[model samples]
Target chain A: MRRALTLVVSGMVAALLGILALGGLSAAATATDKEAANEAKSVSEAAKRAGKKDPYAPVVYGDR
Target chain B: MVEQTTGVGAPPVRRVRDALPLYAVAAAVTVLVLAPLAAPGYALLYDMVFVPRQPLSWDLVAPAQTLPRAVPMDALMSLVTQLVPGWAVQRVALGGAVLLAAVGAGRLVPTERLAVRLLAAVAYAWTPYLAERLLIGQWGLLLAYAALPWLVRAALDLRAGRDGALARVVLAAAPAAITPTGGLIALGTVVLLVWDRTRLRRSALVVGGVALLNAPWVTAALVTGAGGSSDPAGVAAFAARSENWAGPLVALAGTGGVWSAQATPSSRAAPLVPLATLLLLILAGVGAGLLRRRLPPGTAVRLAVLAGIACLLAALGVLPGGAAALRWAVVHLPGAGLLRDGQKFLAPYALLLVVCAALGAERLVARIDREVAGVVLVGLLLLPVAVMPDLAFGGAGRLRPVSYPADWQVVAERVAGEPGEILALPLSAYQAYPWNPGRVVLDPLPRYLPGTVLTDDTLRVGDVAVAGENPRLREVRRVLAEGLPVSATGVRWVVVQHQLPSEVDPATLRDLEAVHEGPFLTLYRNPAVPPESNPPGLGAWAVVMALGAALLVVMAAAISALHRRPTAW
Candidate 1:
């Protein structure tokens, strides 16, 4: 009985973590998330504007 | 467990003397647990929590990069670091993990052995590293090291042929599989499992499953450029380029070797606070554990013997005159070579020393009359616990302000409110920096945990790896180093000092200014440097990989449980 319950819980935890990640990956950025996104984008843009460009130029490299 | 009869109808043995040690251990553990609550800021528990918690790293960088939650011996520190961060959450984590570990140990050993195990844990909990981690809030190291007793249980289970099907072993192996130096403990487990081939199939399943559980980290390392990357002899060459044979050794035991930020020399070892334990290790002749074994370790003594060998190999070097020891010491010991401080060993070695002391306590107790043994062992364990700060096992001190006050979120929000990229001076903050460097940067390619910079960029810890593969990014680093690309280029906010690079100096700071100062922190802002200055790739793939690995583990566990009637013993 205990073993069976543990199995159920393990599945539940994984599923929960998976769905959460998927939600994060797929969902449109929310107001807060977008603010965070903008913050990151600005940091990158500033790095470029400041001459500390994204040394890797990530968008073009291995974008496949 | 071994003493229990297998007959369907046989009544389980019930007796007092047989159970005395366990009860004594429980009573001792209770006292130790209560110590942290009463004392508030004991250093031993603080250090325990600090390393895994990555407290030092936080003191080094910006706030956005801090982890969502803390791990290990560092929980209380993480909480304290953040303004009495709610323990309801961390309490659940720490209590659950520790309880699960105790259950894991209970499955394999007699109550006496379990008590001995707990005794060892109490010793490590009280070590200087743990204390420092606790005070500073290094959750990762705390959880990882706190998981040591269970790893002992794991090793014993493997030896007993129970590794074949123990589900608890899978759960128990969780923290060790996840922490910074986890790979070492896992490697040690593999050695023990290999030593007992009778249960090869079972051992393989258990060990392999545990390793599989680490796939998220391993995959992160791989995708990030670790295992199959150009960094093999690559990055170490750079760290070692300046060092001669004598360098790592002197740095190993001495104060601040190559990585020292200070102008003067100082030994890196922390003053072990549970001083009685240190005296015990030397007088009891533990240096033997380091010298005795070379091949696959056979017994518990041998496993410990090898564990010490591994630490010494990292500490002294494994080769002749500490040569190989220095090499292995630097490369193999989970978080060694990369991070600046050599004192990382303080956590693991101190745990080992404490375990030995616990064993010593067990012996001391066993020798005396029954009534006296319980009293003496509890007294010894209680000494540290009783004085424990809020973070320690038996501490009575309230959580005091570490160099940084506990209001991390405030720091985070304040940094988020800043205009430019900031550098966390002491960059090894916590496990989060490894995952998210945008939150803090000592350098362009965040060193990630206790490893190196400019080296792998793979950012691998244990089996987990986060590949930072962008050849173009490398070229960018070279250019930026020559000089910040432009005013718009340099990092804007620096959480602390000393981590700033040559290029981003006077010219860089001409525009940047400190905007806010907390009780323990100074927030700087460069109105000219925008927040979007240097952005990293969205970790979409890494997230997929971590979730994927976690899924695989859950599946394998379910399938295995159904097929095999793993002896719960």
Candidate 2:
């Protein structure tokens, strides 16, 4: 009975680890994707502002 | 079969072999977390600015107009960068913080099981508190977080009257005392843990030693012309923020809620993350009994009290009637502004939680089958990393290194040749330069250049504008708002940073003589005010004396600790 219980517990923990691993990976990929999107936006903005004499001023400090 | 021992009289080879796993685990964690720092240049994130060589200027040592938030930290950096380059210093500081944090927590656990120790090591080092602080680039506070477990151990030893323990306490706390918030945490830890009615004299000495270590920042705060009071708006601006539906309180309970959303790990927003926090708390509760039984009488209770105070302070801004009370205190009480960003005080709570949870894991496995216990311990070890894997590879590449533009060096040289007060234009306290993409960093001009550089101090947290107490910055803001020329208000040099989102009106630079103009930064000298060199005053010297005294205490403790036959540490 004890051996069976140990096996059951081990299985539960293994399942938990798999779920957590997937969750963590998805979150990390989301952050990377966000960064890439921001970079693309910056590039487009720079192209639009090209040849302009006056500097473009955004918000001094970013949102929290 | 062979037997091993780690007692005082154990063989040196055996001890090293026994400790090999802990060291390996710690190294693995450090390498995994800081893999991005292996790149060539400096990582200049917000408040984490490192220059090639920070000139030893009086303003860096002691501030005359502003609050001494970075008091001895900047001064120490300036002194160290004189010999060692800034890039090396940055690597050492970050690497040492992560590695020492893991080892310290692993060593602090009372369990005999190696798996339990490793659990504590990984759990403590990979905490959300450490992650948020590191992502926000508050490396000084991270040093405090890293030093805490070691400090607690030394304090416990001092309470037990162990030889050289007092010196060990001072040595452990020295790194934490680099910043004011860290200093207070160290002082609070020593007082709570080491205070004893039986050994009153020794307790007083230990507490006094840690107090003196905090003297540099305290002395600077006393002498600063910015005065002690801060804007009450900051109480709301810097409060602990809720990452998910768990709310701010649950976030604090899990040791995850920092003020800035940008600083928090994205995984924290997962709805299930709160469930993990609940599990950890339940485990901590299960292990509380073990902790009380294992520790010396009253010691566990004292640690609990310290942890309680930390949690209370961290949640004060979000609590009922707590924000109002904190607001009133910050406005009326001197040095109370330090309490505004109370999440930084969570270091002690994070340490205590990890230690207790590790013990809880031990208790859980004690009654199980041996093979099952091994599997469970392995699962526990992987839990922290599993929950927040993005902490690996430098917070998912948020901490990538970038080289400073050549314009910075040219501006520094010009300012060094003729030193005077510099007004940084486009008038922003923090900047998002084109060179350092996707990172909002504090204007590096103040530390990179020689003389006193005045940048805007107002902090914009979302849409809420938190006011700063620098009188000079306020005057400069007024001058600029009225559309006055840069030369009219500035004492000497004016730097106009280009390619930033903020624009500097061409009319503002009409009267100033352009000294050096580059693609990134433009240096303009105000011909109206002649260049003048200002020497350090008596207040600055007093701060220096306090730093020197703190150094002497550490040195004396070091000598005393080394002289002892068997080191208690």
Best by lDDT: 2
- What shift in Å separates residue B319 of candidate 2 from its native position after superposition? 0.6
In candidate 2 the C-alpha lDDT for residue B68 amounts to: 93
Cα miss at B99, model 2 (Å)? 0.6
lDDT of 1: 0.39
Error of 1 at B230 (Å): 14
Tens digits of per-residue lDDT for model 2, B94-159: 999999999889888887788888899999889999999998899999899899989999888777
The residue pairs in collision within model 2 are: A57-B501
Range of the 10 consecutive residues with the lowest summed lDDT in candidate 2 chain B: B1-10
Candidate 2 differs from the real structure by a C-alpha RMSD in angstroms, to one decimal, of: 4.1
Can you list each candidate's DockQ?
0.02, 0.26
CA deviation > 4 Å runs, candidate 1: A1-64, B1-124, B127-129, B132-137, B158-164, B223-298, B317-320, B323-486, B490-547, B554-569
